[model samples]
Target: MTLTLSHIKKTFNGFTALDDVTLTAPQNQTTVILGPSGSGKSTLLRCANLLEKPDSGTLTIDEESIGFPARLSAGQIRKIRALSSMVFQSFNLFPNLSVIDNITLGPVRVNGQSKQEAQDAAKSLLDKVGLADKADAYPLQLSGGQQQRVAIARALAMNPRYLLFDEPTSALDPELEHEVTKVMAALSAEDASLVVVTHNLRFARKTADKIVFLEHGNIRFDGPADAFFDSDDPRIRQFLSIYDD
Candidate 1:
């Protein structure tokens, strides 16, 4: 059971965003993607989620595999996408909806869960993320951290096999970032399959089972987290130096 991207490439306006990137995120492990700005970390994650159609590659999620740049039906896309859920750096919640509603919408609308079932699960997820009391509040009423937590809960409601995060805490201050990271830590402890793109070395060191380092749209290193942090490669060392206090 894994999410595999094989020889994936993506470009935008004649600029390459990913170059022959092949990565396999195994089930029940955290794979942290680290790179400098424009390293294609977010682009790779987005490709895995099928938000951007790859110029070329094959995406396989467990038993289902689809080659990109091929004409795909809406049902085909949805079937493949249902295997994973993503939380972006910005909390993309519906402002008009209450917190509980935001979390339940996906499960009810897309996943076809009954409203009661979705709401029941949403309440449990909200409590798990430490936002139970904010259920009736609107997204605009919450702090950034709280909004992000709600985003996490919303992602979880889908019951996806893989949870993809694209710099999930980059918009928050340190204190608010900690609030979201705590929930992520708990999920990691439970051995949820996660692929996270971030510059947060501390969280990566503590939570990542594997680390994939990218540069200039190509993978530079892919290995165990410990090996990545302890690497002697000049590029890896140079990147790590920035996070060194």
Candidate 2:
């Protein structure tokens, strides 16, 4: 399976955020987008799922174009979005909803599954994410890692072909981050396609199948994980130096 982005460009007012950005994410692998702040990594992820629409680009999944040659209708965009689900940096769980509700709402509301069906799916997903016992708990009741896992489950409830993570562990402490990173590593073992935007070098080194480095909204490096870290490229070395601290 593949998700391809061709010549994507996004602009805000007069500022160009993503300039001719293009890349492909393959099935059952992690493609980590790395860059410093304002480097458009997040913008790239947002464009892939249409959270922020690209001014110009072709988005294709599994070799089929999502919308091409013509602008998409709102319904078409939603249909395309369902093909891949996104998990945010901050756990965007509904505070008023219980864990099971947070996980089941998408399948029930978006996928038209029965409540029981949704609950069953949520149950399986919770087990997968190691949050089965917290099904009845509220968001405030869990740690950041637990909430992020719930977020992952909610994304899975839609049965997406690809999962997008935006700085998945940026908000958590190191210990909590490790917990979530293990879950991410587990997902990769299951051949779950993932696209992540992150700066956590240790996690990226361990989890990424490929690394795509961006600077000033353009991809500067795209290669295997080890090569990216071992390269003598000044930009890559300079950016990585901060982690030495």
Q: How would you encode candidate 2's per-residue C-alpha lDDT over 1-245 as one tens digit per residue? A: 79888888888898988899888998889999999999899999988888887888888886458543466788877777898999999989999999999998888888899999999989999999988899999999999999999999999899999999999999999999988888988998788999999888887888899999998989999889889989999988999998523
Lowest lDDT 10-residue stretch of candidate 2: 62-71
- What are the Cα lDDT values of the candidates? 0.94, 0.89
lDDT of 1 by residue, 14-122 (tens): 9999999999998999999999999999999998988888999999997889897889889988887789999999999999999999998889989999999999999
Worst window of 10 by summed lDDT in candidate 1: 236-245
- For model 2 the TM-score comes to 0.95
RMSD of each: 0.8, 1.6
